[model samples]
Target: MPYLNITEVESGVTSLAAAFPATDLIELPEPTFEGRTCHALRIGTHRLEPKPAVVLIGGAHAREWGSCEILVNLAADLLHAHAGGTGLAYGGTSFTSAQVRAIMEKLDVVVFPLVNPDGRHYSQTVDPMWRRNRNPAQSGGNPAAVGVDLNRNYDHLFDYRTAFHPSAPVQVSDNPANPDQVYQGPEPFSEPEPRNVRWLLDHFVRTRWFVDVHSYTQKMLYVWGDDHNQSVDPAKNFRNPLFDGKRGLKDGLLYAEFIEKGDADDSAVLAERFCEALKGVRGKKYSPEPGFDLYPTCGTSDDYTYARHIVSGQEEEKILAFTVEWGMDFHPPWAEMEKIVLDVDAGLVQFCLTALA
Candidate 1:
């Protein structure tokens, strides 16, 4: 099948819920700037209390067409396999029937296939390179100033100028006139897209894992995006005011975000499992690394999800977050994206299995 259009993607969510007995459709509380209602699917057995949840979201960047497809297909595969008592085969990687059943029974697998439908609709119809949600609050009648980079609108060092050193290579901008696509919104969680994601994280209090799916890097990256990770000094972290202007300097000893040694190790271990599972599908080697290894990014989804517990002083469970950049282009052809979707679906299946264990 061709890449799903924005309408079909939302329809896919509703159809999945309608077709499957174990799935429930959750309407996000707010509509997008374009008045599109986004939904998430909760796939698990109905119970009194919640299970340890795994949230896999996609379509953050409008041009990355395959991310949402991968997630929708993954949800379908899991539900079908569990119902039929069969296994799932994606190229060479296969998941057992029991394993699929355990995932359905033991964990609440939440798949939000599309996060920015407005941007996606615009990209599919008008500009294939569009990367932000279609919110014109800051547009000021300039056609180019029509959107906010939803990925960078999260609440992790969102004030990049104050959060990073002058020399750091952070790919974010607050200027509406600057045509670079990574506009970090007027404020943290300013756009409805990121706010909807935040709602999922908040409403699903037991969500322990998150993966904000993206494209074109073939990487599975973990947290500490603001700078290199350091487990030694807990006081020199993102929440600490002492290191406000010292972050984002790669290869510099001035500041490194502090993650617990065990948490850091767990992040790396799960990243490797995702990479390995993807490799098993088609022999495509995916690098597992820290998010800062790519570049300094403030207000990214992965960093924000993982930082919530740290910034909240242990009030919330620490979500082991990741960004799985699949494929080698923002929007690959259907011939190529079809394969990448399977590769990522296999990885997500493995990720859920690992979380269950």
Candidate 2:
């Protein structure tokens, strides 16, 4: 079970759509810095109708091989089960044919398995630990500044110095030299990888759920990445300029991102459900926690998706966004990676089923 290369993964998306009439191949408008185009598969019964969509994206870091594989497999399993009218079972976890059909008929399961093809190519061929996109325009002739951390290039609090406390452990760097390996980029959405994700969400319009899949931690994380979540103080939120310098502080009262009590509860419940399903598929223990529990991050995709309705001033549902860090390493052994794929595919099936409730 060797990992699929970037070409194979991209071709896999096209193959899924070609094999299953229910799946449509979505061509992203922007090409990568290396002039490589990205593709996404939208699977469902109704392609034109407005419906709830569960967007599963991966390969942002490039080195995390399992993320892309898990998503591709999930899409294949759903399409296969729906088309054949057969049940899908992964180890101890099983979904009936009816459940699979409901998923296709009721929800749009959009899988963007590879976000940074150029970075993935570099990681596989040259650097096994490469973690960012290969865009050297801002490198300033410094070899180390060859890439921008796609994860930190989103627009949510891109200005970390103004948005976070001086002592906050925010992981972002503005320097194009990018020595920290977590550069925030010259501006938000500066690179095409993250812009592709933003475009996908905007194009879909009805996407109510989003999961930016990553690795090296067996955790299911929910929104409010910059600070602890609080529903009590609406004015002390990320949009409020008054709390700019006080944000991301661990001191409870100092600052906390505001999320409505119901939204917070929904995020927690769904995350727990996702973890529970993954555990059922081979008894892998996956914990549900806040995104900040990993660290205080700025300009992350999950936080940006969750903040869309609040910040965009557009008519959109408050998306319940998540980040599922699968397995225990960036690149796990192929034998172990096979099992991890099944574990997460099962979890995603349960997530789609739960979304209908």
Instruction: Give per-residue CA lDDT, model 1, range 1-357, as digits (tens).
Output: 889999999999999899988988999988998889999999997655569999999999999989989999999999888889999999999989889888999999999999999989999999999999888889899889889998899998988888899999998998875677898889999988999999999999999999999987899999988899989988888877888789998778999989999989999989999889999998999999999999899899999999888778784588999999999999888998899999999999999988888
> What TM-score should be assigned to candidate 1?
0.98
Please identify model 2 stretches exceeding 4 Å from their true place.
Answer: none
Compared with the true structure, all predictions reach lDDT values of: 0.91, 0.91
Count the clashes in each prediction: 0, 0
Task: Note the residue pairs that clash in candidate 1.
Answer: none
How would you encode candidate 2's per-residue C-alpha lDDT over 142-198 as one tens digit per residue? 878899999999999989999999999898988867566798788999999999999
TM-score of 2: 0.98
TM-scores of the candidates in the order shown:
0.98, 0.98
* Residue 67, model 1: Cα distance from true site in angstroms: 0.7
